[model samples]
Target: MELKIDESIIKAYGFTHQNINIQQIGSGHINGTYLLTKLPSNEKFVLQYINTNVFTNPKAIANNIQAVASFLNQQFPTYLFPAPLLTVNGENMATYNGSYWRLSPFVDDTVALDTLSSPKQAYEAAKQFGKLSRLLNGFDSNKLQATIIGFHDLVLRFEQFENALANANTAFKTKAAEEIEAAINYQYILNNYLEIKDVLPDRVMHHDTKISNVLLDQNSYEGVCVIDLDTLMPGKFISDLGDMMRTYLCEFSENETDFSKINIREDYFAAMIEGYLYEMGSILTKKEKEAILFSGKYIIYMQALRFLSDYLNGSVYYPIHYPTQNLDRAKNQLKLLQELVDNEEKLQDIINQSLLKVI
Candidate 1:
């Protein structure tokens, strides 16, 4: 069944759109997001079709988003992101054409950038994202569901790596084993993952901290807010820091098959670490500081294992373009991890300098 959004249903939620226009606006791999324009009032809202197959529990997912929005509404009442509308039945979600859909009041005059075009944008993203962390400080981590088990656990990822090696088909098993052996020691790269608990602060973390999720004001280029809250859950500071850099600090495409062409951008790394420390330094613990550089290497190795595992397993998890695409991605990530390991000292210095500035 094709999913068609009811315009009148939006009206029942007080959007008051006489003439409705829905345009496909996002390229999100999961949920479908649309921009809805009200012709008479000239107001805009976002309509999201929740992919229940992906989420499994649409109500819980919607509830989590509502919880976060409610918490933010209490803390930073002045600033606003989109807020989900409660249906007449008192539920935030409605069944539409056999799928779950939700509506949120859109923020006017704000735009999410496709790329972090400048240093200022990077800085603002850090600041605004830090603000989100601050706003969510006292929330209970246990109250939120994990959504995906071991979503960012380095140890769990190592287990998956072993599974890949054990299950590879005869065609790729030998090469897969060789790749597995190369990354075997990489697991120890995050041996100190627990040590971070001593120095850095913890809170409900935005697990996917890509720069594109940040909404920036067009004129001033200042970050206004972070959108895409689907992956929000409990984690340490490194999860956010590592994922942010994973998305923002690389010069090469994630899928680059030419392993020799992949290189880490020092300037980009320095800028992102500096920006993150500016917002999170004071709240971070001593142990968190020492492990900050390792976070990059640790997360990269974990992801490399994941991609490689998926490749060996015939693309069960992430989407793949070709048969070996997952392997190519793993190679790229492993290459980056190696670079990060080589630059640990320099990256540490960047973190130290950033801390000094923030302090």
Candidate 2:
């Protein structure tokens, strides 16, 4: 469904179309994206206003995509990267009224999935991310920037949670007592990450691997490419795989208040593992392979920590719809972590079987 948006942003990008149709697009949480269609000509472009508060550096994002697109074009020329289009003055990014804007090619004949209808989508989306990781395995990791520093740094997030807990309101802590205990209980996930974080190789990872970030063929539902590259940076493989597991393995999202609807779907789990390892099995190191089960825990626990931290800090970070939405989200993730832990042995077997299939 298209939303009503003011057409004033068109002028900001040096676009002079007065009668353009502006519709907000995508399911992104951090940025504002719009699909602008100029009437008469019907020319379309994907324009986005970066949330500088989260990224802090827009140039770094543009540079990273440009760098990766350059490498991908040389190594895998046929890949659909869709790098940000340069402004009229040859700048990859445009600045207007202190906000950063980027216009990228609007890929025709593609659909951005809001939900996975089947396990085939789970398999295809995971393969797309895995293939990107595998193709870029040879690129110079130093060329990429940490778009959001510690975006997926589980240890740093845990420390922030500790500080938030220390400074939290007394009544808030009391209200979230059960969630607090669960948060502390999941510290083992953090401990495990600290033990192996240095051993794993840092690849150019799409830090956010939600299904919405992937563009699929309209009819076939096969993944065309990953989009919303603001969070694209150098990070561990688990950031991608773990995010896929956390988002894909469950039919419900983190914001859903009804906890009963958030049960794990093991079919999706097996499909994602089969798909991700299909591309990365040959590329992942033994150490990285060993952390597959922990990948789900790593991101789920990290996100739970973040949501719980914000809840304790009086909902200062994530936007809240109700009085205790963050607390609810935190609880939701903790339940997910518990469910994943209960099935770790079984999921590990799925990973093992997936590795064997790819070999």
Candidate 3:
């Protein structure tokens, strides 16, 4: 559990070791985050260590972050992103202890997701992300290389899942075979993803759009800034919306293990669409609107399949807490997918209502 940030490296970068205080910050499971505080002046920074196991190329990831930040600085001055603070050599990243680390000024008046208490908060969150999408239209996607190839490819993901199932030696695979088959069937609906991708206005999207990535002002539920810009690239708005819905619409707590406890928040879904379409209603097409529900189902099913495959392949992809952890996760996600399918009509109505407001 020890993070190997050296004191000498801090001093070498012109920040005194005596003044700087670094403490671990609770981010997601993938990467490590540290809230760095400077004494006397009391300046703060977020020093993040890139998860090398997941993001193999540190240089490319740093470059991608730099590109996005540079773009934001030039284009949208009001929206604050995590702008990397360069070192003495004018480099934003530094290699230390067989890992990559970077620093950025810590944004004040910011709160990441604990839980969405009201519909208004959810609506505001969605609206802010829509604004983000509207603002980032027509950026150069060539600059951001896919650090993890086949990340969004549903077909490739299914092949990997099948391989995992075929290779599994455990008895768990026997009981889960039916659920896996159902998930596989749903995978077909997403087969023509490339054909339908044009519906949603494609641009530089925050591919990993979870509520935690947005920093909301304490006083106002309005989203202040979208942080964690590592996944910004050329993807459909549906990818962001799908990921956001996947994370936000779940009623079960993060620690919930039982599949029966899972539920999808329809009101939450409504608020999310309300928030999102508020910013980019004029830009979205009819086809895009029609396919939004499919996007939600596809992404959720994709995650479940991915988790199951990783589990069957000896738990290499995601860190597992228990023997049945991955299986439980897959089941929970499938339940979420089922709920989304059931509420498809209401979800579409929400989108249409939001669109009418914007029009």
Candidate 4:
């Protein structure tokens, strides 16, 4: 965690660390994040050096944030956007020591959770992400760069799985036989996506909707605003909501090995669907609404494919603790996908009821 933050970098922004106390914050793996506080004035700003390896074009990120912040300010003046503070040279990002850096004022009295404790937290997070897309409904998605290309495209993933299955070693493939069958059987999910993708409108999406990505009021637990804008890009609406469904509906994560503990929480699903549709229902067309209910399946199946494919490729993409850990994770996501499928009728009923009130 040792960061040699040059004194000149702080001074370039017309601030001095001598008057400010710096402390490391956030558990993000991609960037080096810190909170800089001026004690006497009681002002706090979040500072970070962009991880150039993962995000090759740092200025594209800066430009996208600036554009989104400008839109939020002009359209929804009250919304909180953690827009990057411009350098003295009027640039959104500053290059120093061969890395890009930016600063933004910290929103006081807000906290982010790495896990969900209640269904209400699920609702609040989903609502905030949905509201952001609703607000940016008019923004041109083509203007934003794809930070990671085909990050959520099931078509590419399906091919990746097929290639891995075809070329996988015989013994490892046999070891993962059950999970491999499940992956092949789940090809229908990819077909379902292909059928609906053309009609599902691409929007200005969060691209990553983990609960940790939203800052909530510390006391009320209501959402304050969304954070972690590195993944902001042009993507289908399902990428965000489906990600929420994948991560929030189940109590345990994909790492859990106990299959019995992987059941979907109906109440959490209801809250998330209600919250997201409450904001996005009117904006979505009939085809999109009919198609979006299976978002959980879409995400879970794709993730299972990724894990299974990685396992077939000798455990390359994801680090494996034991030999079959990736296979176990694939099984975990598949079991959860089955739970969603089994309760599909009930969940569809919930979606129908939510649409009645929101649309």
By TM-score, how accurate is candidate 3? Answer: 0.93
- lDDT tens per residue, model 3, 1-359: 34767875575456867888888986587788888888877888888878888888777777877787677778987677767788878878866767777887888977887677877777777777777778766567766877777777777888898888888876767857876787777776566575686555657777787778888887876788777867766776678788878888876653478767788877888888877877877777778777777778768878888888876787886777887777778878888888888888877787777778877
1 or 2, which is superior by TM-score?
Answer: 2
The residue ranges of model 4 lying beyond 4 angstroms of the native Cα positions read 320-323
Candidate 3 accuracy as lDDT: 0.76
The C-alpha RMSD of each candidate to the native structure, in angstroms, is 2.6, 2.2, 2.0, 1.8
Which pairs of residues collide in candidate 4? none
* lDDT accuracy of residue 308 in candidate 4: 93
Between candidates 1 and 2, the one scoring higher on lDDT is 2
Tens digits of per-residue lDDT, candidate 1, 1-359, equal 23466655565455544567777787577888888887877677778887766777776667677888887788778866566778777778767556777777777667787666666777777777777776677777767776656888877887787787787787776656656776876756656665554455557887877776778887897778888777777778788878776766666667878878766677777777777777777777777777678767767787888888888888888888777888888888888888777777887777778888977
* Angstrom error at residue 287, model 2: 0.7
True-structure Cα RMSD, model 4: 1.8
Query: What are the per-residue Cα lDDT tens digits for candidate 4 across 85-124?
Result: 9888787877777888898889999999989999999999
- Ranking the candidates on TM-score from highest down gives 2, 4, 3, 1
Which pairs, if any, clash in model 1?
199-285, 199-286, 199-287, 200-285
Which residue runs does candidate 1 get wrong by more than 4 Å? Answer: 1-3, 6-18, 194-202
Query: CA shift at 222, candidate 2, in angstroms?
Result: 0.8
What global local distance difference test value does model 2 have? 0.88
